[model samples]
Target: MARKPAAAYPFSSSPGSSSARPPQPNTNLNALRIPVTPERRPGAPSPSSATTTSAASSASRNPFLTPSPGTASASPSPAQAGRSTATNRPYGTASAANSSTHLMPPSAASSTASLVSSSGSSLRPQPTSGNTPRAALSAPPLNTSSKSATTAPPSISDKFSLSPDPSLWGGNLSLSDREADDYLHNPDPKRDRKNDRGGTMFTARGIVNLGCLFIMAAGLIALFAGYPIISFFTTTHQSTQGGYNLGGINQTGQVPEITGALGLIDVQTPAASKSHTGWMDQSTYDLVFSDEFNVEGRSFYPGDDPYWEAVNLHYWETNNLEWYDPSAITTTGGNLKIWLNKTENHDLNYMGGMMSTWNKFCFTGGYIEVSVSLPGDPTVWGLWPAIWTMGNLGRAGYGASLDGMWPYTYESCDVGTLANQTQNGGPPDALTTGDPDWNGALSFLPGQRLSACTCAGEDHPGPQDSSGNFVGRAAPEIDILEAQVYQSTRTGAVSQSVQMAPFNAYWQYTNTSNADFQIYNAEITEANGYLGGVYQQAASSVSITNQNCYSGHQSGETGCFAVYGFEYEPGDSGYITWINNGQPAWTVYAPALGPDANTGIAQRPIPTEPMYILANLGISENFGAIDYAELVFPVYLLIDYVRVYQKQGSTNIGCDPADHPTAQYIQNHIDAYSNWNLTTFDDFAAVSGSTWPKNKLIDTC
Candidate 1:
């Protein structure tokens, strides 16, 4: 049901026209132009006032368009049925109805006043508001429908008075800007509360802050122009053992800190023992064991937090632990800082920053046993995880204890020799000075060695001159453990020592003396004296000292620094001040000492044929850390410098430092003995060639 528009609002003349009557355009501007209207002439654009034809069609159903009930004037007596007055009107507005009689019959005013619209002719004007009558008349055939004077009412006194919408002409009655604004912004009264919209502001601030941060960072870079940038990798170069080598197992970027996390070459750490991600880069991983110390010396690993996964080597990535700046160990200037953390991330095999050199780098021939500190708490396992190496490592086939003994036992150590000794050898008291073993033991000459500065009872064997002055010096039975190969010292030298006695012990107990040993992929041998695992069986020197060379009941005594480093000045050896965390205790030693072949100590004692570097942590089952390992390739060992120098030569064929095939290959032949994966005789035998049972001693079989 459509309603006809109200009586056509006579297009009120413009307000400005009040005083200055202007010419009118032929058509009406009653409504916006409907260009789509059919009446639009062919090719001629329609007027802006064009209206819809449907408006006329809808006039029939709507009473309002029916001329308002009885609005017909001068009833045509039913004669003017087909004759009608019609015109377009804007939607919803009334059409201006007036007496056509006035236009044509000026004198018929009275009759027209009382007369209604000609029955079906057109709308009639009455005294709806004003008290005046309009003359009756018929509209001229100018197509009143089309525009003419075009169709504004004969006269409209006031434009605003003609319609309610003054805004249609840009007047105050229209929706003023302020009114529109108020309507849109009125907002709910309830909305009057504290509004903290940190939306766009936050985003903009974030962008600004981000910009500031970048600027600050750039400034910092400029501040430290010469310093290396802390970037991950541009992948600009390849990973070599040198020149950005990244050391295979180490992080490729700046390491802001390292604390609870393992070092680059993480040794037998809880991390390595569990997860198996970096099993391919074991050697470099072992270095991380450098921080295996736990709670004042107890070992810490996944055992403490079974949920520890690979520790992100990047300091910034350390979300678990706190970052600390200590007085030591920094890649930058000033104080060294160590950022450490412990978190839970899937905790898969539970590994990281831990590794080994089962058959990597270069280490073969005579056994090596590492002795490091053990945790004070046995219940807390992983206290003495070791980081010993070996190469060439081929032992007596299966029964030989070490299948890769020759190359396998190259760098080996008894697991926790101090407490786990019976399995590796007899006790310290039962330790036979010299013995040949295949699995992994070292043989040292009888008696210890002491310097001229100390007494005879210190590892010294015979008298000096004729003064009965001194016999031999004291012998270092075994103390703390060894470190993971050589570390990067301050000065970057590579000189270190391994106690040959324990390796001898390892070999003796295993009963396979002929196993080969290698170092840095070269046959294990002295620079000139001992050639490739061969030492003169002939007797050597015997020196002992009261310090670091005592024996028997006194040997298992309080504390001592068994191994001291010296300058690589061809012949000058030095010692470290003995101090237990800071306790005063003179090192125990014997009178004099002797060497089978190896010699460099002040006493020129016997050369340790096949030395073993025991994991210091494993040695005590308590100290739980590598006893002070001093690798003083230090041209001046006295300065505590010197790093293990890797020549970075071209290898014809072997482990690829780039892809790290060595560690992978070793993992294929090795397995850590743990609860989840206990080492079996078969597993150990697979690699224990000739002397299988002898070398692989964790025999649950």
Candidate 2:
């Protein structure tokens, strides 16, 4: 069916008159302008007078026009087919009917100036409250012979003939003073009546239009200012570690309150940590490991220091497709660069770089700091980069029992016992029942059993009281910062996890289940005294909105660059602290002491095993899953520097600071280690010789 068009409404008060009465001014003039017909007053004059005048004038001026209103009868007439008489009107309104008898001669529709001096009196509209007819206001007769009158069509000024002072409507309108004076000179009743009705209607229409305009403007502002504002406050420039905006989260997943200068590298912390002058950075220290990486030639690459060696062992561990490649290492811009390039070698499709000071240099405890830039954006899948360290006890010729072992193993400590006469030899202890082979058998060093299972029934053991309450323990495998860029696929955010080897019978266990770890991604789990994966207390994790990802596919901005640090000071009861930029994010009392000493006093022993420093860039799927296909090729892990500083006057070992292991080796046999630093080892030969200096029993490792 075809849709019908809506009926049109006549603006004039009467169709019989060619000249419309000027609209009258009223409080409801706006409402009357709407399509709805106004109800007729009870004592209103019949339309016969208007019809007769229009008909008579039409016939005299132009015979082709409709008949005059004077000829229309007040009584009913059967000859008028579709029209109804005044007594039998169908509609309640007098002006509702459309008929030929209701039109006037065209000459009567002239402008206001033409009608002013007419001989006959003209009709005007009455007030709204008046029961009289709307167009009953009588005006002076027009002078037909007036020469000044001209026949021009009426305009808006004639229809809206009322007071133009906008202040009458609460001083918010735009009417001018000149227009108000014109309204006062010409008292138009027709215009006044229409104004009275239309005032309310136009006001309503204006309010609706204004509301729509406001909404559109608000939406436009949000579109333009949204992202820039977010990027400004959340960008990495705000802090070298994590940017914590107002009511927003930091990289450590902490929602900080709005305080201090926003979008600046200022951190608000407790008075104690901020004022504590004993932090490693504040104390005087001697440079132990320093690789400016300013050397680049045929004789050197990135990890080519006399104290460093390239790890060449290849394995398909952690779903990683990359094999360790020595060629991927390079030194440029005064810093070490580990390249993760997509290259096919033999059956391998991807290659990465890894190097460490595993055996060359190891210290008991001190400060380890590194300024490194991660390989790729956190949104880039399969990009895993890390700067960390592992224990040196697993290396060849170490005094510890787990020394000279390829895959480090831990002995089961199902029954906690305290014993001396310890000797450092090979893997596993025979302290528990139902064990297989000599792997768990004791290796005696003539007097004492140096390495034995201490924590009973504990898989991941730490320093504990007699009742198994957690005390403290030194963490092996100190991960300064692990940048598993795509590690948050499961948790849905870019995260940093600080992993440390858990306390096992064999101090630095390499197994994942026995590793003591802390992640900012999610909740912290407590690994109790039950085989090195259980603990007494846990720090609950909370969800945080990750704003570290780029806004577009290739925005050319990674959104984050943080200075990460790990410090171990055994003198402070094995206290370990993780530093984000210069502010301390968290601190843990991780002593390398066991519960077997059975003493609540300070007599409990602390771990003196030396730990080596390492920094590598590799792909791993251990912490979180990865999609290798989604990665961008030719990624890089850029290191500004890796520095190791120790207390100036303190000595964990009796060796002089000038003749320490790393310094001594560099002074005498620097050529041996530095010459083959880039070579990939194809055989399982230990990088050791008899010429290497041997230290005391306590500092042997």
Candidate 3:
């Protein structure tokens, strides 16, 4: 069915005019209708005058309405059809609507009911205030026509152009009457209590935030407290072989037996022993040699043991007053005992025992430790007991064949002689002139003796033949423990030292003035601007003392036992360390010893030759004359055990004869120098044997 168009509003201006407006199709007629008998103010214009007044004059009188800019038209525009006459004010404003009703044509009065009946109550303007007249604002009769029933009501803007005064309405431009009613009826309790104490802190979100903070704090406490708590309950055993208590008491009062985590907290393996000195890992060392002396009544004679042999010679080097007798050394009750006693044998009034592994065993780099109880007779005078080592090329008893290598730590050339001088002032030959090669060059060897070299300018005399000519090279020596009683004052004093011949080139090039090169407990000669100067007799010593350990000379007392240890490594970064009962007493780095100045080669020159161990108890005349009347007789030096350890898959023993030149070759060289035909020492040249073994030397092994 076709729908009819909405009726035009009464006050709409005509088309094609300045005041023309769109039709108000759905505008409420009640809001625009003129009253039958409108009331007027006193002295107001008559109704005829008001009806004939121009829109401009009327707009001037009423602030709520304004006229079009130009002339009024005869008909309304399509857009002005249903629009309210109240253009500047709200539709339901009682005052504005009442004042504007006089502008409506008298003809609009009769048409008001028909327009309202057609538009229906849906298009009527609602009263904004309770004071507004209900009769004036009442809806018309309901429209039963299908067109009016289906049609939507005009928008509130078209029916009632209501705009409240900003000053009176508090600038609430968007709030309608219905919205204000809703605000008044339903209030927000939370907003009303916003300024109250603890309002935000006690909120649901605050509770959740506080809960998160508490959880984080708890986590931090657990993070810090977990370790010690776990450690308290755990048994911190280095090994896992023993039963442990697990916070449970047993009826038998024994520790509970359990396995795995509940029983123990093993921090390290059984083999991984802790290093007392903190320099090296103790677990990496393997026992390469040990003598516990468990066999009772065991003799320490020449043929008694395979690993050790007693020295039966007098120690003439130190001018000792004791003869080292084999009988003075014995294994009694699981201990090797060296007895010091008065004796008339060997033109000496005293006798003691010395044992060594000279030819039988040797090691290049290792840890050597000895558990020993020194002779502690307070009355004993001139008593000196020592545990020491020497290069394998030297024999302990000053054997004629190998005695020449003493005090030479490293292999070196004889520097005192001319580099190119020949043997016997004759042409170079295998018999007359020996090999002069050194460091891959033909040069003067600075330390090695007898190798076609003269001992004229050398600081120390080398081994001599029956004719008093230089014969052999110098060997190195390391003193592990030298317990001496000097003038009856140093009763329990002990010292460790390293002895070597002054390798001139080493001192010549290095900054000998540096603290690293300073010599301790040794004599120094500062002649010729030599800083710490060359050691007068190449020996440096450091005293070792431990107050907790027994160092008194109390014979047969187990309380006198101490563990003396020495660790040696050979190379540029190598070092020799002295340890007293697991604590480092002293250390010497190889590089601090200096290098060869001539060739700038062999910078460290640490002893690389394998060395054999020796321990002796001697009564020396060097300290003082022994007071036999006050000296205690039959005092003993007890040795519990001697142990040598090396790293895994490594050995310090260099006693294999196959690794060196044949003994015959060395003998032939010595024999070549037997017939000294040269009249002057200047005829000799410092030369080394070309065939001399560069590695291990031929030893007694």
Compare the candidates by TM-score and give the number of the best one.
3
TM-score of 3: 0.44
Clashes of each: 208, 79, 34
Give the number of the best model, judged by lDDT: 3
**Which window of 10 residues has the lowest lDDT sum in candidate 1?**
633-642
| TM-score of candidate 1 against the unseen true structure | 0.27
lDDT by residue (404-447, candidate 3, tens digit) is: 34555543333322222123332222112222233222223223
Span of 10 residues, lowest total lDDT, candidate 3: 240-249
RMSD per prediction, one decimal?
23.5, 27.0, 27.4
Whole-model lDDT, model 1: 0.24
By TM-score, the better pick of 1 and 3 is 3
The per-model lDDT (C-alpha) reads 0.24, 0.39, 0.49
